[model samples]
Target: MNHPSGLSAAAVQVYRLRVTHPTDSVTELGCRAGLPPEVVVAAESELTRLGLLRTSPAGGWVAVGPETATEELVAATEHEILQLQVALGATRAKMQALSAHYMEARSLRSARGDIETVRGLDNIRAVIDDLARTATTTVDTLAPGGGQGEQALSAALPNDLRVLSRGCQLRILFQDSARRHKPTGQYVTRITAAGAQARCLSHLPTRMILYGDDCAVLPIDHERTGLGVIVVRDASVLGFLRWLYDHHWSQATDFFVDEHESPLGLSSVEAEILSQLASGRTNPTISAELGMSERTVARIVAGLMERLGAGSRFEAGVRAVQLGWVS
Candidate 1:
């Protein structure tokens, strides 16, 4: 009843005195309850509020029957508890309905700002593992340069395998340079055996990782050779990254140990060059990216177009996509 001093200390004294005396006045209560007159006045108000004491129009106060008061208190407490349970259930349903909207809102706000910043290789790897455990569709990765160190690959292999085991599509794009690194190749071999698909690209769009099509994590360092990473859940940004992934994926070499893609009667290098050409990279850019010279890149493009019965580069690209070589 909002008593200022808290659950009144005199409730004890009042209850004790009321139990023994049937007709107790405030004056007598003040004396027998060992309470001051002022305390007696406040305690009486509280007792009347609790229905433990009632005002008797004839004079002071009368005790409410202890059995009846206990029953009333028990009934009131049960009523409040039932009401609380219903309120809690309704709140939980409201939260469930808002969850999709919550994710959408995250995408919208994250479009303006990336939400998480992670650094240190170990911490970054921890975040990746956490994401993988809950990811729905696929785990897509781009590893530039060589392998990301033997230690890092070792740490990531278990969760990578787990994702594949759960029937999640696990696709990784590694640089051609990675083939020479024994540990990374071995890791790739193991995961591929577990139903993951890996490809090697002479060029990659970025050094990053994507969980499903909605969330992305990329290195903040220029070279992507360091530990800093930024985590993003922005829809627009993820869409563009996913597009880039498809682009590179089309041009990458399927990394089966003995299988090759030279159906155009071209060498492996020439087939790769033609794939990049179909994807719209400039000549010098291709040369620098694929470690080919200007002369070599020009010669191969000419040779490929001629062999495909195409008079121009544009014609070759169109033919390539139509043939499902660069789709």
Candidate 2:
């Protein structure tokens, strides 16, 4: 049996045995394997760091503490295997789909391809308008890096708000970094206030817009800096985007503007302070943004970091993102 990481058969056996008998001391494990105690100890330490094992009070190793880690590792390995199978499957699927689409597009391409010129802002607006008109059930979007201009925002928001008004669902995903922007918060607040559901993920892929099952828009130009290209009428692409959205949505927390205003909780200001730390913002930046002194911000960030069991800002960000406090 080949290990996923391509470890030798003997090494795989050693790893499996170590995982199964985590309470065994290095001396015992080494004795069983006819290896040196130091080697076993080093291997156990490496596994523990990789999150495949947990260290015991007696300094022995056990399998990961949470059942989820074991399950996740197994699932990840299975997913890789399945992905290989799916790639083989998709060769046939793609050939059939491409042949059909190619024949259909041939005539249109011959007739209209020459007439098509540069796609500008107007073209983008037209697409957005078409999306708004066609959306029947839902719209899911992920926006990152804060450069979705005013016009696009206005067009998308009104239509989305209208859809929400008429009982259609709208869910938007934003990165945790967006929370640092006042304008972004205001926009999110406005949309959420109008009944559109929205949440923020700590980290996400490039920005995208999914309109029901009809269209998926991704950046064709500069994904990091410029506007994106929209892929319309592509069900397969839409399905992929939907799957990606669901995966991130599962990891994201339900974001409410007033989440901190619960019957028993911190005030909004305190919550924002905690959220800033969670977003990987430095105390000085938080102080500048929130209009507080750096010292106060440091104290607040420090207290929240301690409470969250985070040793560093990055860990705090991960925890906060997991809990949906900041993003």
Candidate 3:
């Protein structure tokens, strides 16, 4: 586990098996999970360290509630991600594995036209891509978290480009943290340049893809299952999604990235950082909270302090407020 997992697949599988079958031993857990005993042991160690699992007095392991476990998993995963090498042995593997199970159990086409379930990453991608391809007027997406990785973005790029070329309106709203992501930024740049309109909101409703006003696809598991996608053809539910998109869109700012990594004026990122700093957040806290690197947070703080002509962090806060950069 210390060597870094290609994805969190191994850990997630081990955890899933133990959580569902608390009495299972490491060997039993491995057998149930279809992983090696050593892998399950390693994953158990990692999960216990993360506080998601605990060794019961009976010698087996037990999980906390799913909600609590998921939050801990997310934080632990984010920390691990920051420590990973430049290459992305990203979260795709775990996402796919969990989603495959979801599809097997739940994926079904409904005749009533109320709702339907799609299975597998490929099928989800195919449906979403086809929707985007055949969209007559609009394709609106709320991609929260860190945004999709370079590979996912790359695969969807052609479909996205086609959407734009066909004179369809494409609007994507990403979390503000996404603009600071190197690869995510590249994709955003490409899409924006190709006539797609983009915005950055500090928060988002959910990960959803809405084609025009009716058809919609939304993730059901989010932080837990990685791939539980539900296709909602219900007009009322889709209307609410559109309303949610509109609400967030109105509050979002244009994603303005500075090429020089510094702006004569306080850039949106700088302003956001300054706002967090004003709340007396430390460098590490700011980095984790904003999904930015600690070094990046430090440099921004130092630069802002110098630019404010301030001798200390307190003075910088005052300057930022007086300048109306963050209030």
Clashes of each: 0, 3, 0
lDDT (10s digit) by residue, model 3, range 90-172: 56665777876765643243222567677788888877776776688999888876446777888878999999999999998
Enumerate residue pairs that collide in model 1: none
lDDT of 2 by residue, 92-151 (tens): 887887877865774464341132222566776675665666677888887754334465
**Deviation (Å) of 286 in candidate 1:** 11
Candidates' C-alpha lDDT = 0.77, 0.65, 0.76
Kindly report which residue stretches of model 2 are placed more than 4 angstroms away from their true locations once superposed: 1-118, 146-152, 222-228, 257-327
Worst 10 residues of 1 by lDDT: 256-265
User: What shift in Å separates residue 8 of candidate 3 from its native position after superposition?
Assistant: 54
lDDT tens per residue, model 1, 1-327:
533635477875676687677577667877887788888788777877777887668755677876787799899999999999999999999999998997687557556446578888788877788788767789999877545578888888999988988889999998665665688889988999999999987667568889996588898873554658888877788889898988989888876543355665665666667788888877887775664568868988888888778888888988877877665
**Where's the lowest-lDDT run of ten residues in candidate 3?**
103-112
Task: Flag clash pairs in model 2.
Answer: 22-61, 219-228, 220-229
Better of 1 and 3 by TM-score: 3
lDDT of 3 at 22: 89
RMSD each, Å: 17.5, 24.9, 22.4
Candidate No. with top lDDT: 1
Q: How do the candidates rank by TM-score, highest first?
A: 3, 1, 2
What lDDT does candidate 3 reach at residue 26? 74
